[model samples]
Target: MTESALLVCPHCNAVNRVPSARLDEGPKCGKCHQLLFDGQPVELTATSFQKHIDKSDIPVMVDFWAPWCGPCKMMAPQFAQAAAQLEPKVRLAKVNTDTEQTLGEKFGIRSIPTLVLFRQGREIARQPGAMNTAEIVRWALSKISR
Candidate 1:
């Protein structure tokens, strides 16, 4: 039997079962018919956040940020670049702490631009502050491999 992984659609938040070996083959969502990995971080809300964390078989790298933060703004492009490199292996997402205050409180986010890595519905690692593309990718991969 082929190994399959569950991936939550970033666009529609629909769960999809995809063959593990074919992750880099550009899989599309069954329900929404959208490409699963678009080389971009998904914008997640409080309602959709838990589902992605709980359902994804791969590690989820969440950037908890606010619009007013300067470091957050600087890291946005770096995060997106990291998404392009890390997709299929990791689900990169962003949560606006300003809008999702409840989520921020739930996660006990003490600072802006916090990078939280979740696997199998549990947080495995977390980093506070901004990082460049190389730093983000390296940090995420290092954590996931542990």
Candidate 2:
């Protein structure tokens, strides 16, 4: 039997079981019927944060940012590029601190552009600042290897 991983749908918050070997083969959610991985960072809100973060068997990397921050704005495209490069192995997500203040407060986010890596519902590493696409990929890979 092929091993499978539980992945939460980015669009509808439905949990989907994807074969570990077929993660890159485009899995769809049973409940929502939406593509599970889009090779882009999923938008996270206060409502969807817990499920996606806690339920996923794969590592999740979140970018906590505020629209008003210049650094956050500048790094948006870089983050997106990093997401495309990191997907299937890692799930990249974004949480707008301006819209989700509660999440920001819960995470104790004092910076505009903060990246947090979570596995099995617990945070493993956090980087507080804007990073380029290459830097983001390097940082995420380095931390996950540990």
Candidate 3:
């Protein structure tokens, strides 16, 4: 029997059940009719963040950032690149600390550009700083098996 994964839609916050064997084949949401993985980081808010983290069977990597932080801005493009390289295996997301102060506080995020990797709704490891695309991808990949 083929297994399936529960993936939260990045665009509409809809929960979807996708076959694990067909993840790379490009699945669409049954509700919004949107592609499940669009090769980009999902912008998460306080309301949607929990659902994505708790429901997704795949691992989730979140970049906690703010608009005024220089390092955060510098890492934006690199994070996006990392998303393109990591999806189907992991889900990349961005949470703006400025806008989502509660989430930042809940996660104990003290600095901008903090990368938090979550598995099964729990944070496994977190890194505080800016990293290039190569570094980001490498770091994220290294944590999956842990």
The C-alpha lDDT values of all candidates are 0.95, 0.92, 0.93
Q: Ranking under TM-score, best-scoring first?
A: 1, 3, 2
TM values, all candidates: 0.98, 0.95, 0.97
- Write model 2 residue lDDT over 1-146, tens digit each, in one string: 24999999988899888889999888988987888888789999999999999999989999999889999999999999998898877899999998999999999998879999999899999999999999999999999888
Ranking by lDDT: 1, 3, 2
Off by over 4 Å in 2: none
**Which portions of model 1 miss their true places by more than 4 Å?**
none
lDDT of 1 at 45: 97
Residue 43 of model 3 has an lDDT of 96
Look at candidate 1 and tell me the lDDT of residue 69: 99
**Count of clashing residue pairs in every prediction:** 0, 0, 0
Query: Candidate 3 residues 79-105, lDDT tens each?
Result: 999998998899999999989999999
Taking all chains together, the TM-score of candidate 1 against the true structure is 0.98
Per-prediction CA RMSD (Å): 1.3, 1.6, 1.4
